[model samples]
Target: MRRESGRIPRRSFALLVLVLGTLTATGPLATDLYLPAFPDIARELDAPQAQIQLTLTAIMLGLSLGQLVIGPLSDAVGRRRPLLVGFALFTVASFACALVPSAPALVALRFVQGVAGASGAVIARAVVRDVFEGDEAARFFSRLMLVTGLAPLLGPVLGAQLLRFGPWQVSFVLLGAVSLVSLVVVFFALPETLPGSVRRPFRVVSLARTVWSLVRDVRFVGPALTLGLAFAMMFTYVSSFSFVSQSQFGASQQAFALMFGINTAGLMAGTQVNGFLIGRVDTSRRLAAGLCGALLAVGVLGALALGGVSGPWALVALTSVFCVMMFSVGFVLPNATTLAISSQSPAVAGTASALMGSLQFALGGGLSSLAGWTASGEASLASMAVVMGSVGLLAGGVFAVSARWAVRPAS
Candidate 1:
């Protein structure tokens, strides 16, 4: 039973968070670790730089579609089975990505890797929802964000070092090892969160109805859109910034890594602050505060871009603004997740988590790629600013429009 006290016997809670955080982090680690290797992969594979960005798009598509399938699948069968199966696939795909002979092949493997990695994200959220609610769930998610934030903080640096000493493939090997270790942890440390008594058998009609009901509910829809749109802003920055920094500002690989890590640290700081404010602030108010901060930073980014800022000063300016912007993102992510999941019944938490994640990756990955494509098939610092600002405005609008129905839908 979930304790409203939000206690899990300190040591056990620490272990549980570690295990779930590791699971939750797999996709991001996969995504972020390979970022520094983009130029190398493009050069070695004889592909255009623009085409290389497509690989990011493909994995995101897989992540979106995978959550749609695995979330409901876990609801019907169980989180344990789907998680194990997904991790196993992730390990295999990670290794296979190391051996692909061409960009197209690598993209195909990345899509599979993304699909597999998504099982971890969807399952982690469902597990949290299964065991916690209200303030307790929100606190746990803040902790979870701190864990996930480490991926971008460390991934690019590790990837750049690997690329410097070895090859781009070495990064994929690391991902494979991480998944293999995660498999063992899942089997030993994590237990099934979804109970058999509440599991509805996987059925097409019932699945459709459950999804429809969730989709139309503003309580769930508002926070989920809020989360997804904000993520689109973040993910576009994460996926495309290497090109922006290197191609536009003349940054080296190591410099880019450090830059990425610093911004990520800002994000973790935001989450840490959110954790401290758990009882002091309500979710909607905090979320609104975050949107305001992010939109304000987005304005700074737009001014710099529109002014045609370039060279080293532009680099310093962009990094500072990005750090401040991502700091606010830390607040947006965890609180939005808690609201959406808490609004759902545990019986369908898997589905609810899945829908949120699907929209998150799909919107996050899909629309931003167009920015790169429109910029003559290459991402630039200016284009990143423009696209993110547009999306941030849209997210703010959604949150404002949906404020009336923030409470859970009547069952």
Candidate 2:
């Protein structure tokens, strides 16, 4: 909605920040909180490792697909309604997942859960665009990072403790409860950020046209793909880390959780620094610099892995570099997102945001699947390192090309 002069009221702005932060954090926490329980899930469900891995894929697929639908629907209808509906579905699906008796059933439920959970991930960003532009949007996104980044750091620890005291199913139950709480809070508190005047018609051809235009637009495609590739790097690591830590490094689940927390801490630090620098540096330069740093770190880590340095400390060192690269993500993600949405009409913001989200999760899902197919406990460390490094390199290339094509010529 266009606020009078496009400025949000202070109270509305504060609430927007809280809602966006909560929504952004929920998807990651849901996906990651039970990571330490993966081994146990396989054992309890009497499923093979590959079957257990499908649950993750299902969630990712649902997330991408849901956003494709939900984002456009939000544009046609409104933000608050879609969010409430998605949260309600997510809450129910969480309970369904907790109660599922078989691995296949659980996978199916997780897919449904992901679809429902997509609202927050897609709409939160769109809502920011709805309310703010340029530097203000960048600042809002950074604030979002403050809360979203904390979830990963905290989720693993919480998951570890829950696994220690109870069955792995407890994690799903807890997620369901959290979704319910979020639903209630949003139902009462979240305003309809998308005003009716700017709402697009809900026609199939119109939606397809919006997507086609976005795909063809250099401005949208470049930043959107950059964000997607950046996310793919993280997904590759998340998908493979457990096997590497447990099989290669001989770390317990608790140990892995601790290490994961450290990496998230690095991400938080990066987000904070990026927040401070958003207004000072040009967004394009900031993204280019961050991408370069990530590329270098990942390259070095890959070299170490290739050189037969497979010890625990080596893993830790490489992981720390990965974490530092993660911090630089703050520089890239928000800026790319802001750029992607900036050129679109307000009528199509939801569709544009949806496409961006869909592309990101699609990249993530594809990479995670590839990692699962190629990984083995014996070669887990090297494989994970290679995957992360390769994704980083690919992302860097994408950003460089996008920058060259998209950046304006100097006066």
What overall lDDT goes with each candidate model?
A: 0.89, 0.81
Model 1 lowest lDDT segment of ten: 1-10
Q: For candidate 2, what is the lDDT?
A: 0.81
What lDDT tens digits, residue by residue, belong to model 2 across residues 7-116? 35755776777877888888999888988888899899998777877888889889999999999999999888999999999998998888878999988998998899
Q: Which ranges in model 1 have alpha carbons more than 4 Å from their true place?
A: 1-11, 407-411
User: Residue 109 in model 1: shift from native, Å?
Assistant: 0.6
lDDT of 1 at 267: 96
Q: Model 1, residue 80: what's the lDDT? A: 92
What's the distance in Å from true for residue 167, model 2?
0.5
Model 1: per-residue Cα lDDT over 84-133, one tens digit each: 99999999999999999999998899999989989999999998988888
**Against the hidden true structure, what lDDT does model 1 obtain?**
0.89
